[model samples]
Target: MVRCSSLLVALCLVDTVTPWAPHAAQRWARHSARSANPQDVETARSADIVAVAESFGVDVNSRNKACCPFHDERTPSFTLNPDKGLYKCFGCGAGGDVIKLYRELANATFAEAVEALVKEDRPKTRRVAEVKEVDASERIQLKQANAVAQEVYAEALRHQTSGGARQYLRKRGINPKTAAAFGLGFARPGTARSLTKDMDKSAFVAAGVLYQDGRARFGSKVTFPIRDACGDTLGFGSRALKIRKDEAKYVNSPASAVFSKGSCLFGLDVAKDAIHATDEALLVEGYFDVLALHDAGCANAVGVLGVGVTPRQLETAARFSPSRRVVLALDADAAGDAAVRRLCDDVLPTLADESGVDVVVMRWPDGAKDAADFVAGRREQGETDAAIASAVRDLCAAATAWNDVDVCDIPINEADAASSSSSAPPDDPPPDDSQDELRKKIDELQKQLAELSAQVASS
Candidate 1:
């Protein structure tokens, strides 16, 4: 079901139908003859709506709307939903997949459009056969590059006896087996002497595993491998081992053909199996927090990259566990406070149609920074494994419903109250006793509201 608001359909998927001609055999043959990579073919079949709109010089603003290309209009009516890769036009009723838009805008046959997109950004090369091979199968090459980079990093991590990253992991109490399971690695401190030193520069660079910054971009850091839902390595998240006032404590690989920030949740590849079994998710803040929680026997734990959880991430979460029992165990800081406010005020009201999905804010006691710290503290305090696990379970069990908009505390909207409070008929005698009863009820409600507000403020 597509969510409707401000001409936006919130739940449309990328894999939707495009307009096709009745004389399809000729077009299908032409389409089959193109040298399209697997990912490109999948993308065209289930198109990226934003890419199609961008190709037509449409600027989709923050509101995700652009001017209608089918017909000229000042106010924009065409809306593109990034979460689902879908586009719809309210004014002209021109709505379909990216292929349909390409056909309409270019005034070309489906074959022509598909061929044009398939050959986009093909690089000229020294050898004729290699260049042709690269152009013919670029997505496969990208995947192969990622796999090679993953192997190099994993091997570097496996032989980590002399590295500070191993010591750091030891200090954090992450076991060697857990580190191997998550593909954690160490980036050596020199630009020339590095793990990616022997790899083909173009491959690693395109895969987003190697950066061309003057210094090694991930130098002297612990690397966390980020993967797609299918467990394919996309990129790496880096944490500084030797922090300086000049450098950021945390940094990540730049967006490439595979990696898109905030579109992925860390540990999701491992956590999804557990989530599917339980139909619940334990969401945390950082990569290490997710690892620690998963290590502590909370197999359903997953972490987001940033402070605020986006609607797209929630939609991704919903796909795994349709039950929508996502427990947000973010840090107990100002950012977490703001996150909950957004979750309740903005994110929740829009999610009313998402069946029985409910987001619970799992608040920890004040001064406990985050889930990772809390788990580490438990280990330090000499708690048994069962006790530590029990404590973690209790934290989730004590979650509060973020969307607790009590009618007793605040009256329904003025329009609703006014409509409901209207008299039955003008000809009938007004019941003074009923009027008194209504007045008493309002007074009681106001008193209860004041008490509730006071309690909240005090807490």
Candidate 2:
């Protein structure tokens, strides 16, 4: 019995250290918890200890002593060692690596904390004049500033006076519960500048919440909180409730230390679990599309923050979707088609070669503008929930793989127009073809074919 117990203990230790142990899945929940991936764990552990501490607002002086966050203490007891990538507090007897420091300070699960650290957009070593690089300490402060701003915006939306924002959401078919779940908010005029009045102006400015001149980036817009998979509020994506003649209809917070348009995916915080569960990711272009798909029960949807999906965004998606399947459900307009063509011609091929992931593009329902519209149309036609899911699945199933999709094909709009014209009835009746007319038409076709063959042979 003693020998058997010792052997069991040894086996458990080995299992804990193994890379992606098979039992990891059974050990954690999909959404709230993460399976321990050894590579990710090592990456998180290797981060700078002092920098990680500083990210949580821990001030370490020359001696690396700070007040303990875990226990009440008047004197400094928490100590961080950068060289060893570890931290300890004598007062509370707490100790661990940088990952533990982050997990505690961020109030995150071990997996969530690791994900956050690994996914952090670490600034490059080389300095670029145009883009400001934020150190660990400053980055935390910026994130804190964003958190406060998001709260302010959310509170503004909940206010009785913010009916216009609520009305806009209603028009979009977004219920109150869904809006609240997504952290949708509003930034009233003058509220932006006022909200930063009591906060750190420089931090807010660096966070892209306030302009350098102290003006707010969003005003009278329905704000969407853009967060990472770990639920850290990075920035805001806002749509104007009432578009000003000179102002754009939509605006995103400017690139900052915590937020980059190319790297962030809208609704990722909410959709990552579904992506992991399905082992697939549904990529869309608009924020509304993400919301719509999630509401329709297709929760694996995420939206690109910019005009098109970037490699950084794809990399992040691939991390969650272990099966490495991505379905493109971008808009069905001419611009959307052009973007798809560009991806097929340039981006998807290279990504396929490197990652060996299967990517496909979805075919839109007739006359639908985007995913949101497509879902809305189905609902309007009285489709049941399961029926809608089936329809969506069918469309995905019918999509062609990226490599097989022909980029040389004309745009959807052009093809639609051509089809419409060819099938429509002619205004005048066709005249009978004479023998000479038939022969002449055949001869012209033969001449064109011969010319194409000659050019092909020459080339």
Say which candidate scores most in TM-score. Answer: 2
Query: For model 2, how big is the CA root-mean-square deviation?
Result: 17.2
Local accuracy of candidate 1 as per-residue lDDT tens digits, 244-293: 99899998888665566766778877888787676778888888888888
Question: How much is 261 displaced in model 2, in angstroms?
Answer: 0.5
Task: State the number of backbone clashes in model 2.
Answer: 0
Alpha carbon lDDT at 58, candidate 2:
75
Candidate 2 regions with alpha-carbon error over 4 angstroms: 1-133, 410-459
TM-score of each: 0.58, 0.64
The C-alpha stretches of model 1 lying farther than 4 A from their native spots are 1-139, 189-199, 213-215, 352-356, 405-459
- Model 2 clash pairs? none
lDDT of 2 at 191: 74
